[model samples]
Target: MFSLIVGLVVAVVLIVLNIVLSKLSFPKEGRILAILVILVGYIYWGFEPFAHHEMHPHVEHASYSFDGKQDIEALEHAGKDATEIKAFWATIAKIAEHKGDAVAGKALVTANCTGCHSIKSEGFPEIMSDADAAASYGVTPPDLSIAGKVYDKNYLIAFISNPVKAMHIEHKYPVGGEKVFPMPASDFMQPQEIADMVAYLSDAAQKVPAPTVKKGASEFEISKAVNKEVFETACVRCHAMNYAGIHAKTTAEVMSKYIGATPPDLSQYIRSRGEEYLHNFINDPQRKLSGTGMPRVGLTEKAESQVVEYMTQIGDSKKDEREALAPKVLIYLTILAVFALLWKQKIWRDLH
Candidate 1:
């Protein structure tokens, strides 16, 4: 988190430096070189692949892979009415299906995509083949060949224009709630261009079946560990400790007065907000609730969700008996660990 803040500061400084350098009376040749260097550095900084590129998996047979060759054949083989595309997409499968033109789609992708994307030869992480390109973009662009097999024309057209609206649950980096990074809004692209690209991508995705799901056991374990850390730092300060609400006797008494004005009890808040709002508020408050007293508590989406889940489970109970017990357990465990380590090392001194 600190590093991310520092990086933002560094980026600002570099932008200022670039602006300053432009006004200086440098030689024409030197100025040109400086501009070129700055441009290159900026691109590298944004992409980061130039410095530490993750290598793309290589395609085994080069000659076999043509622009739309395999994709077109796959779509053709899948057949029109009988294919899974019809089942999945229903009426929306017609646009790609009607044209059944992989060649045109590939041509469209090549012309419009090169600036942001790369084919086999160009760019740091060479998009080795169709699979390579799809993976890099973070979702499978439809296989034009098989695209007609699945979605109807309307779905394809709508999807090409605005990906965020189309694949909210899938394509995006999930940050909780409806909030996400403003991404490649395809509004500027000509209608024909979007149609062509959609024709290509939708057709392409069909050729490839869904990628196999990786085991998330380790990921789940890490999430649990991070959740505990987040809870300790944030929630423990308010809910568990006496610091949550107004200065009254018990937490229940404090919370009764603290309902609207103060940060409400986490136990109650979780039930009121549900998982989505709670998750969003933890990651970024502004996106979820209006006039949220909760400051942006620095926790990742995954961690926030996990902590919320943990809290919600406890919310079923009304008692505050476990509140003070958690701290006692922590202190006892800390003492035990320290004494055990000291005894193991034979470092225990006389209690003068």
Candidate 2:
């Protein structure tokens, strides 16, 4: 449009110059200049539609989002956005619908939280601190699990966006120390981003169990009980499913003695010892069952009993049954091998 106006103005100036020059008797040069200006204006007018702005036409489509919605309709579907970019638009759809965007929330967490607190292949705190809330970062990163139990969506967003609003006397840190650690104020986060992050955190937090209390003990019976309690309190941190396998290292000895390498069958111990003995072993494994990596579990007698009762009562898979099933597994593998060989050499390959 600007070019068109400029071309018109130039054409008018050329015409006026031509008239003036003709009156002054320089007709030939003036006519040439006027014709050039008119030609330029015609070219500009012909290309006027291209002057609006260089915008590629847009196309739209349907896609999925991490905000718990699927197959959201998309506007402006054109672009190299069909791959991972689709995830971003799906998040936009959720925000449009007033639902929270967890994928974007995860990005926010990676940007903000990963430096301090992280989960397996997820986000920060590369190594965890063994010390309690009395340690650094002032207050421990609250187990995101159950955060929503204590905090509402608005409360979480507000606290995360600017914790100073919630950082009054009762919530004040320092606990008698000189240093005061507080959540950093973020003008960096968008209001909707904060909302999405809070929503994501709330959902993530809900998947985790509540924090448990640990108590100390010394005797074997007490130690096993403590071990059980410790398993609940501390061991669960590294070992999921009562040390069945989660993060535990497999023993080559067990495999050499039996089949290859696998975790020892713990189902037998739980059944034979009747939970109490196992609890003691757990409480103080070094003292009671020396030369093992099992850490001492500081457990109160009541906590030990609770742990004992829990193990004995729980209907876990039986070791004997699993062992018995092993032969059947071997037989299935043998049959599969025979069939595969027959299929390859005798029939299927030739058919193909």
User: Tell me, what's the RMSD of every candidate?
Assistant: 27.7, 31.3
Q: How big is the RMSD of model 2?
A: 31.3
- Model 2 stretches astray by more than 4 angstroms: 1-98, 119-126, 132-134, 170-180, 206-352
Per-residue lDDT over 1-352 for candidate 2, one digit per residue giving the tens place of the 0 to 100 score: 5655776786687678656756775568666776677677666655764443333222221111122122122223333334433454344344344567787887887677655555432334444553432144433344343343334453355456445322222123324544344457564666677767767776775555433334553333453443353343433332334343333222233223221223333434566654544654654443333344343333334444555554543323444467799999999999999999987877766787
lDDT of 2 at 310: 40
Q: How high a TM-score does candidate 2 get?
A: 0.29
Provide the overall lDDT of each model, using Cα atoms, as 2-decimal numbers: 0.47, 0.47
Segments in model 1 whose C-alpha atoms lie over 4 Å from true places:
1-101, 118-190, 212-352
**Candidate 1 residue lDDT tens string, 1-352:** 4445655776788778777887898887887888788778766765673233233221222111112233234457766343432333332333334543556767776765544444322222333453343334422232232233233345445455544333322222343645343335565665555567766655554555432344665543444444444454345433442222322112333332322234445656666766655654564443344344343433334445556855654553332456758899999999999999889667545542
